[model samples]
Target: MLEIKELRAGYGEAEILKGISLTVKPGEIHGIMGPNGHGKSTMSKILIGHPAYTVTGGGVTFNGKNLLEMPPEKRALEGMFLAYQYPVEIPGVNNAEFLRMAYNEKRKHEKLEPVDPLDFDELLNAKMKFLNMDSRFKERAVNEGFSGGEKKKNEILQMALLEPKVAILDEIDSGLDIDALKVVAEGVNKLAGPGNSLLIITHYPRILQYIKPHHVHVLIRGNIVRSGGMDLAEELETTGYDSYLKGK
Candidate 1:
């Protein structure tokens, strides 16, 4: 479980998240809907300990541990995963190798032995097959020449391999086609269970159509303005964010 309270963070001297608070309990899927540049991604970055942003106030805890105290790699080892809005391309790194390295690091964190390459291959292949991805993906450089959909799929693949306790998907729906969206969403749904939680941040409700979040939140101007069930997302689809933006 993850708990964020009165979190105030921003880049440099400009503040973006103004005392926002949210809690993600185990087995729950929470959708955070908001317009662009209004702190949705900022929240994700801060949660994962992105150094560019400074936490001027508030606190975050993961499974009762102080999350803000952990470094980014420590955060990942602690089961905090962020699927970025724009997944960076690491041209020189083999996709499979990078994945294996990351997966093994987590194992090492758990005081488990690293898996053999052959065994890891079997594991990676099974995950890729479930995502409907081709085996050739293993040979390609990480997101180097992948399409937008492929990059998003790769992010999901990482999620599957890591099995984080809490996964924060920052704009996972961005740049995905309908087919890609379905595949990605289905993969995500398959990974959800009673032991893990998801925080899906997006501007639109289309992905929620497939993921079916347990709770929906409307964020505007760096703060969560409303929280409800799927009905709030349905209403957002029809009325848009005009009502929330009127006074701002």
Candidate 2:
């Protein structure tokens, strides 16, 4: 339900994405594989309307609406979610309160009434349980003092609560241990269905092993060099990106 065409964007005067194009259909899981600084995360940031980057060219549409026109909060309200590579720690905000506020805002966007805190607590507890997270996490500040895995899990927890139509996970696999990866992947798998889509961006194929993307793409030097099925990821494991990087 997301379409990006000839998309070009970068920080300040340097462009990192050059004519990148891709489509994410409903219920599809697309994996974006690439080395560091090759525009994978840049693509995610642009999609989520990060203000630091400017769109110098091309267009992005979500469910037939002009995504580039929407502000970051509007993007989130419109079902665009980005699980950050490094989830920031908000030391003063209560984790549960922050989540409830966000959830309520989405509800308000839909002209629905905000949920009662008690009701929200029940819902949050259920989601945390599914992710195998401790209830004490709700009491702490957001991502404050959390381990790498915990921060990543918190991101997934947000995803679960929001249930966005298209979730762009930017390096969600980074800093996660094997056990944490499995839990996070399992949560993603559980969330996947016919109504939602996922764009998973990562440098390695380990996360792809669990997520099982319907399509795999190799993005290098600001462009997508190749697109294929899961086999591409398997090949990448053995062959690496040397062949693709040769002339680029």
What global local distance difference test value does model 2 have?
0.95
lDDT of each: 0.95, 0.95
TM-scores for all predictions = 0.99, 0.99
> Which tens-of-lDDT digit does each residue in 1-248 have in candidate 1?
89999999999999999999999999999999988888999999999999999999999999999999999999999999999889999999999999999999999999999999999999999999999999989999999999988999999999999999999998898899898899999999999999999999999998899999999998898899999999999999999998899976
Per candidate, the number of residue pairs that clash is 0, 0
Q: What are the C-alpha RMSDs, in order, of all predicted structures?
A: 0.7, 0.7
lDDT of 2 by residue, 114-180 (tens): 9999999999999999999999999999999999999999999999999999998888888998989
Worst 10 residues of 2 by lDDT: 239-248
The local lDDT score (0 to 100) that residue 127 gets in candidate 2 is 100
Tell me the RMSD of model 1 versus the true structure: 0.7
- Name the regions of candidate 2 deviating beyond 4 angstroms: none
